[model samples]
Target: MKTNFQKNKIVEHPKESLAPKSGDKKDYTQSEFEEFIIKSGAVGSYMIFRSENEEDEMGISEL
Candidate 1:
């Protein structure tokens, strides 16, 4: 079986805060981000990994 997938352009990074900023508040916690994703109609697997440099990373794949 052959599988084909089209690349998607990520206009916004997941780690970026989706809520409007007020004063110096511009970061979203993990739970808040997850909530935003769910509300945005995202349905698939979400993965969190660590890069070779030990920096944390995450991504969401829509199935």
Candidate 2:
């Protein structure tokens, strides 16, 4: 018996966050991000925004 090691495979790395300013926000959750992906059938990219609330609420949305 011979083993075939010539098969091509792709390895994808975990997505990385952009700048720190966006990450600091705390309103948006991962589920929302995933929902957007599922509803839209795809998510090319996304971004975070800090609202002008007294407590400075933050959330994630499509970029």
Candidate 3:
């Protein structure tokens, strides 16, 4: 029995499945973002935090 709400439930990509738990705060600087990247360890060897609105992409060769 699928309802309107159930049907309307949007399915996200597997890679983007887990979202940030906290949504209260917004806006992050490049340095802060870089710190997060280091903590997350998304980057294998070389890493660079680009923007706040960007997601850290892993398992890719540095170019």
Candidate 4:
């Protein structure tokens, strides 16, 4: 009973958690990023970029 849509519904990527939650406007600066990486580990899986406004430039990276 497999249809074209059902066959295409398979997850292409397992580590494809790039998108953040809606309206979750958390941001950080370069210094903050460096501080975070320093405090925590510098290993991540994926990341998202938003650099329209200087204040709005932020990202979401998996660790």
Candidate 5:
């Protein structure tokens, strides 16, 4: 008899606050975020922001 194996994918949804809501220190610096990516072994990451004109823009940084 033969047996087959399959790998399972795990997804996590962690709640994070990017900005301080009520004078609380909950935000992280750009360098800190970059360090996190490196430590997490992520291949790449990107960010999206809205400009003053309400236009969506995408930014990518090389790690």
Candidate 6:
């Protein structure tokens, strides 16, 4: 038996209010990000977002 260990970097997603000052004021929510990942059909994709004090993670569906 063999085991493989690989480390990967996680990219953080931008929150609505965290957008740049010059950026649009559109509301960015969790669902919107999820939709984008789903529509793009990306595999092994995850999102990182900050809320309150802790970081979060979300994955796309395998459908």
- CA lDDT scores, all candidates in order: 0.64, 0.66, 0.64, 0.66, 0.64, 0.63
Question: Candidate 2 clashing pairs?
Answer: none
Per-residue lDDT tens digits of candidate 5, residues 1-63? 234586558777678746647887746798998898889976535445567655334443542
> How far out, in Å, is residue 19 in model 6?
6.7
Q: Write the per-residue lDDT of candidate 3 for residues 1-63, one digit (tens) a residue.
A: 224654555787577454567774666788999999889975666445565545434333565
On lDDT, the stronger of 1 and 4 is 4
* Tens-digit lDDT string for candidate 4 (1-63): 224644555666787565777887666678999998988987567565557665555533543
Q: For residue 32, what is the lDDT in candidate 4? A: 91
Per-residue alpha-carbon lDDT of candidate 2 for residues 6-58, written as tens digits (9 for 90 to 100)? 86687886798556675577657999988997998774455444667634454
Q: Deviation in angstroms for 63 in model 6?
A: 32
TM-score of 6: 0.26
Mark the regions of model 2 whose C-alpha exceeds 4 Å error after superposition: 1-23, 43-63
The lDDT, on a scale of 0 to 1, for candidate 6 is 0.63
Question: Of models 2 and 6, which has the larger TM-score?
Answer: 2
**Candidate 5 clashing pairs?**
none
TM-score of each: 0.25, 0.28, 0.26, 0.25, 0.27, 0.26
User: What digit string (tens of lDDT, one per residue) describes model 1 on residues 1-63?
Assistant: 235697768686677556566685646688998898889966556545667655334443552
| C-alpha positional error of residue 44 in candidate 2 after TM-score superposition, expressed in Å | 5.5
User: Superposing all C-alpha atoms, what RMSD in Å does each candidate have to the true structure?
Assistant: 12.3, 15.5, 14.1, 14.4, 11.6, 13.9
Q: Which regions of candidate 3 fall more than 4 Å away from where they truly are?
A: 1-26, 44-63
